[model samples]
Target: MRKIDAADARLLEAVQQDAHLTAEQLGAACGLSPTAALKRLKRLRADGIIEREAALVSPRALGYAIMAVVMVTLDREDRGVIDRFKQDIRNTPQITSGYYITGDADFILTIVARDMDEYDDFTREFFYDRHPTKTFKTCVVMSAVKTNGALPVHDLAQSAI
Candidate 1:
């Protein structure tokens, strides 16, 4: 791993908050020349500090009004079943995110659909047919108080020592 100084940490924080910021703008914020700033940004990417950048899309605007977190518990303890489930869920676009967790559930899935009917159809056709197991769901994402893709680089830098 590359050693990141205070300047690099500041640059990372600034860019993560707004990737669209130009090198000159970022330089001004972090106390570096435009040329130096661009070089540092390139170095960060080369070091794998900055991953691919992407736009955050709203689910509501995209026709997916319903958001649900489904906890799936597999009947069998076989690893093959879990592997198959992971692959199947990856292929299914409705399941945005899935995690293999500990406790009562083997996997937790985050799903978004047009409405309850669509979610029901997905559960019946996709989930039920492939893996027959017990599931518990919680449907309350009333409001997203805080959602950020940015990581806390300052804290990470402090801890690196």
Candidate 2:
């Protein structure tokens, strides 16, 4: 990965917060001309500094009232088992995010469902029958305090420099 300068970092901050920001607005936010901002934007996209911009959809609004954090421990940690598990996560649309974390659990997943029964069904389909998931723990979210995944680009850049 390439290092980002101050202006580039500022532009990233603004764009991540709101992808709809025009060249003029981004330039104003980052103290650059519209032309300069546009140029930087193109470079950022080309360099993969800025990945695809996507809308943050709410699962609650779409009748997915159940949100769960599932910590899974597989019986075996072989390459085949792990690959199959990862593929399973990708195939499952209800599993929004999956992380191979460094902890007691082999994998962590963010799962959404319409209700309790749906979530139970998900566990049976995903864990019980599919993978060699030895044990899995579920933590139902009572409240989502913070969900917007905006990075602190400007601050990180300042510290890095």
Candidate 3:
């Protein structure tokens, strides 16, 4: 892992909150000059400490009403089956996030749809018709108490950063 100072931590924390912030603004927040801040930011990016920046769009605004948590159990646990499932899931856009999980389900997926009908179609197309899966269960999300949050950079290393 690359070593980072307190200034770097502060910079990361600031940037995580707002990626569009100017070098001057970030420097002011992290107790550095604009030039120094930009240099540090560039170094961080080069070292792979800072990943891609993105804008989070509202699903409701885009007319997506339903969000479902799907638990998928595959029939086979072989490498070929797992690999193929991962590739298929990666190609599917409706399944936003998927994890090869432990416990009851082999995979957990976060899916978004316009309504129940659309969701049903997705299940029929992906789960039943295409893949060889044993069982699939879905839990619709009513509301999000807390959706997305910034990573805890400050708490990670007080001494180093």
TM-score for all predictions?
0.85, 0.94, 0.91
Tell me, by TM-score, which candidate is best: 2
Q: Give one digit per residue, the lDDT tens place, for model 2 in 7-115.
A: 8888898998899998899999788999999899999999988878899998889999999999999999999999999998998899999998888999999999999
lDDT of candidate 2?
Answer: 0.90
- Model 2 TM-score on a 0 to 1 scale: 0.94
Q: Tell me the whole-model lDDT of each prediction, alpha carbons only.
A: 0.81, 0.90, 0.88
| lDDT of candidate 1 at residue 77, scale 0 to 100 | 57
Distance (Å) between predicted and true CA of 93, model 2?
A: 0.6
> What is the C-alpha lDDT profile of model 1 across 51-150, one tens digit per residue?
8877777888899888888888887759888889989989998888889999988888888889889988888886678885666555646665655668
TM-score-sorted candidate list, best first: 2, 3, 1
In model 1, the number of clashes is 0
Give the deviation of candidate 3 from the true structure as CA RMSD. Answer: 1.7
lDDT of 3 at 49: 88
Candidate 3: list runs displaced more than 4 Å. 158-161
